[model samples]
Target chain A: MKIRPLDDRVLVQPLEEIESKTSSGIIIPDTAKEKPRIGVVIAVGTDEDLREKVKEGDKILFAKYGGEEVEIDGKEYRIISRSDILAVIED
Target chain B: MKIRPLDDRVLVQPLEEIESKTSSGIIIPDTAKEKPRIGVVIAVGTDEDLREKVKEGDKILFAKYGGEEVEIDGKEYRIISRSDILAVIED
Candidate 1:
């Protein structure tokens, strides 16, 4: 199904986090196991200011556990609100 | 020092939480020990829209762990941003 974010919300595709491990390759267990905070913007919200600040295909840093998770056609996505977005990642 | 919240931030004086004990006198420990989410608005931000929605002396419900704490004249207060404010409480 197709989805379009409304208002100041944005649709994002989360990137796989770099593995939590030491240089020696020992995996360190993260007790919290929080959701990854890096993603690429799939779509910017309808708000004018939001559209100006962010655009589709931009990499972004979002708050930990910032958005609601959804699964569509065996793929995962997140719908993030404006406050949850921390910064636009350049390059 | 006097504080005036700039932008969309609000200065608030938090109300003590009613306690985590049950009516039968069982005390439940909060593992996270998060901050309270309610307060009385001491001052509203300079944003015109914020000012129209909130005012001094209004009791409000804010987000959990939403603001920064500050002590002034031996009294405690919090600086809350607009996104952290959930709603105004009416008596």
Candidate 2:
């Protein structure tokens, strides 16, 4: 089933962080790592103002713990309000 | 010194949460408590686009773990990007 965010919410798919290793080559466990703060906008809410600021496929930086997590078709996603979106990443 | 948040960042002074007690009247320790998710906006960034969306003195809901904490003039404040803000509390 397709998930659509309502109101000022947006659906995001988080980008994976590369594993970090110490100088001794010891890999840090996931539990000890900081949460990722970047993601791609998959869907946006219907709010006129919010729609003007964000769009599908935009890479955005968000608060690490801002949104609700959901799993769809084995992939993880987050639904966050427009205010939680920090900045759009442009390359 | 007054803190002026840069870019789309905002300075927030967190609201205090009321203490909760169990049926036996035992108070929970602060360490065991959840972070406050609400705050008063003390300052907003210079970004014109962001200024249109948020304003100083607006009470907002933010991600609990989102911002960077700083102590200024005996008061605690957090500096967070606009994206870390979840919603405006209008009441």
Candidate 3:
């Protein structure tokens, strides 16, 4: 089943950070990792105002602890309201 | 000093939740308190697009961990981007 957000909500797929490696080639452990705050918009709510401002495929910066986490087809996704989105990152 | 958010950012003052009391009149401790997700908009960004959607004194629902925390004149406030706002509560 596809996940669709209600009202002004949106679905996002978080982007993973590149693993940090020390000069000696040692990899950092997950325990020390900080939460990723960036993601790509997968779907947007049907609200007319929200649809006008945001669209699918946009990369965004979101709050670290924002959104409800869900696993879809084994991939993790977050369902967040429009208010949880921070900024749209343009390349 | 007054804080003005840049771009589409907004400054918010989180509303404190009323302590829940049982019939016996026991006060709940802070440790069990959930983070407040609702706040009052103190200031809004200068972006024209954002200004049309949000206004000062509007109550909003936001991501709990989305904004940067700062203390101004001994009052706690959060600075968050427009995208982090979820919904506006009209009561």
Q: Could you list the CA RMSD of all candidates, in the order they appear?
A: 11.6, 12.2, 12.0
Q: Candidate 3 versus the native: TM-score?
A: 0.47
Please provide TM-scores, in order, for all candidate models, with all chains considered together: 0.43, 0.48, 0.47
lDDT per residue as tens, model 3, B1-91:
2344545898888776542132213333556454436778988865789999999999887776775664444466677777789878765
lDDT (CA) per prediction: 0.66, 0.68, 0.68
The residue-by-residue lDDT of candidate 2 on A19-86, one tens digit each, is 21322233335574554377789888657898998999897877777766544445666778776887
CA lDDT of B72 in candidate 2? 88
Better of 2 and 3 by DockQ: 3
The TM-score that candidate 1 achieves is: 0.43
Candidate 2, which CAPRI tier?
A: incorrect
True contacts kept of each: 0.00, 0.00, 0.02
**Model 2 reproduced share of reference interface contacts:** 0.00
lDDT of 2 at B8: 88
Question: Comparing chain B with the reference, what is the TM-score for each candidate?
Answer: 0.78, 0.78, 0.77
In the order shown, the chain A TM-scores of the predictions are 0.77, 0.78, 0.78
Task: Give stretches of model 3 more than 4 Å off.
Answer: A19-36, B1-7, B10-66, B69-91
